[model samples]
Target: MTAGPDPVAPGRTTTSSASTGELFGAVTRDLSTLIRQEIELAKAEATQSARNAGRGVGMFGGAGVAVHLALIFVSLALWWALGDPVGLGWSGVIVAVLWAIVAAVLALRGRTELRRVQGLPRTADTVKKIPHALQGHEEENS
Candidate 1:
């Protein structure tokens, strides 16, 4: 008797004969690869955005320092004008008191705003569901 064609032979082309489970597995693997690629793309985009933002922030920091120096000169001029009425020492003391009050108000507001921030809750929730998705429970709720 002649031997029949072996399905298990090497270099066989799988066509319509592939089972449903095999198709499903292939789809699952493809989907996993696509997801990983998407994740890498997102990471690259985020890094570029962060670098751009860092450069912008550095420029802003330079501008802030320049403005601070200008403000210092303006404060000195104010102190000199105020000195015409009061003594020079009292004018300097008045400028110091005004700056101290402004500093206190800013510190209080910054602390309040910082306290109100909550960290990445939506991202945490999505990350938590990943294990369930891997276990094929992705459509369970739907």
Candidate 2:
């Protein structure tokens, strides 16, 4: 008697499926896409950090202009007031020194804000794990 067709196993695909090369190609494509997405994420993070850095630099520029204007107007008033007690030249020097202190404080504040900016923390963290994942050591690295 002829036997019936072999029964297909449960939870398994037919042997007529894709070849090994085709499966490898699919994995390669997926991996390439993942790498590209990671690169895009890194670019976005860099852009955000650059904007924050720009803001810090802008604060420095604003401080310089503000100090220059204050020196021109407010320093004259201060110098004139001190001119009575001290000579005009010494009073001018005192006003100039005060303005210098104000400029220094403004510059320090801008530097502090710049230091607060963090660059690519998340991106760097994830990138470090990519090699481990590709090597099939993801669990160990994690």
Candidate 3:
């Protein structure tokens, strides 16, 4: 028998073989670069999301201001219409007082709602768990 062509020695390396240390260094470098890229992507997305949120808030504020202005104009028109028939000046004063009260109540309620909205936690729990989730996915894949 021809001794099965002399089985290659277990730890012997050919000229083309990469050392474990070099392989480990390459893998580490690649992983570091990948992690940095992911971090940058996350930051960019967060900034974009913040910008969108700001735009949305600005639009809401503009619409709210417009609606409030329209409400005041309509209230004034009603007051003027009522003035001639019912001692117009007193009617206007009474209407203005009532509208002011109503506006104050609405403003108070809005302030409370704004506080609630502002107090909401900004941190995303899902983002905190991403590394663990990725590890789980890798294990599953393996």
TM-score of each: 0.54, 0.75, 0.48
Model 3 error, position 51 (Å): 2.2
TM-score of 3: 0.48
lDDT of 3 at 126: 36
lDDT by residue (tens digit), candidate 1, 67-139? 8898899889989999999989999999999989977996786567556444444444455556667677865
- List pairs with backbone clashes in candidate 2: none
TM-score for predicted model 1 compared with the true structure: 0.54
lDDT of 3 by residue, 34-107 (tens): 66866766676677666766776687689788898898788888888888888888888889898889879978
User: Using TM-score as the measure, which candidate wins?
Assistant: 2
Q: Highest lDDT: give the candidate number.
A: 2
Q: What is the alpha-carbon lDDT for the whole of candidate 2?
A: 0.80
Q: What are the lDDT scores of the predictions, listed in order?
A: 0.70, 0.80, 0.65
| Candidates ranked by TM-score | 2, 1, 3
* Superposition-based RMSD of candidate 1 using all C-alpha atoms, in angstroms: 6.8
* Alpha carbon lDDT at 91, candidate 3: 83
Deviating ranges (above 4 Å) for candidate 3: 1-16, 80-142
